[model samples]
Target: MSRGYNGTEYFRNAPGLLSVRLKTRLMWDGRLDGADLPTAVRDMVTEAHFMNADGRLIQERIRQIPELLALWREAFGAQSQPYGPQIFVAIAEFLKTLDGGDTWWTAPCAATR
Candidate 1:
């Protein structure tokens, strides 16, 4: 349901973030290293067919958000800035918490009883 800013539809459907921690490879083509989540996030953000965002611009805009800045300072250190890499790392950390463990999808089928 999403398209790039340039109006191009992605060739492959975006996969769900669920259980990403258990994946050994990411993306439909498995081009990215799943063990390196930060890199995957950076690629998605910078890719022309994806976010198409400039890292410098993203950091500059983030610097203006007081709440986000406060969070960055608290998370990284009092002197930390909202640099692009840290942004990707933070996003990757958040994505790691999206695991679907114990959800109904993991439960045995009741009809099998």
Candidate 2:
């Protein structure tokens, strides 16, 4: 019911992700927890309508790339192997920094201007 990756579907445009850290609910219908971004990322990535990605497959793929493996090892210690939850958590942390003052609800006057 929303936009997706790789030209997968275009039934409805997805909402922009900027300023999600300020939201109290997530997704078009607010079905996800805005405060729990890692869970949101996990849901979106695994959902067929969204990224349609398998975490195990993604982990395997990343494991094959030496540079990515090295980076992961550096960040997560040498024994880590691109675990799914860890990856989602890292992505959520990065997303937390994506504030562009873009949400109209957070700045109604800016939207009217």
Candidate 3:
């Protein structure tokens, strides 16, 4: 767990924000309501000792990257602009696609089955 100045500890895995998307409560303490993933992501990004980034500043920084902008436009179309909500939602959706299969630990387990 990563501890902040105020002694708020957060989990590193952030599983609810990753593979397990259906979880209701997030963070190590489970204080954040997980009903809305985008909102949760926004909170994480702006939280102290976390990303601590302003949404508009993040948007502008992302917009400055042409390649990233092009990729976002291609993947989500023009309507889905790279604003704070869209960026966070897109990142969450992308993280959901990453499977922890085929690792050494899983491989050994699979062979035994």
lDDT per residue for candidate 1 within 19-105, as digits (tens), equals 898899887788878888999998888988998897787898888989878888888999887899889889999999997886665
Model 2: residues with Cα > 4 Å off, grouped in runs = 1-11, 101-113
User: lDDT per residue, candidate 3, 1-113, as tens digits?
Assistant: 66653666755644433344656766667777755666667776887766778789888887899888888889888766678878888877765565554456656566665
Off by over 4 Å in 3: 1-18, 33-35, 78-80, 102-112
TM-scores, all models, native as reference? 0.85, 0.76, 0.67
Assess each prediction's global lDDT (C-alpha) against the native: 0.84, 0.83, 0.70
User: Ten residues in a row with the worst lDDT in model 2?
Assistant: 102-111
Give candidate 1's error at residue 54 in angstroms. Answer: 1.9
Candidate 2 clashes between residue pairs 3 or more apart in a chain or in different chains: none
In the predicted model 3, the residue pairs found to clash are: none
The superposed Cα distance between candidate 1 and the true structure at residue 52, in angstroms, equals 1.0
Cα deviation of 7, candidate 2, in Å:
3.5
Clashes of 1: 0
Best candidate (score: lDDT): 1
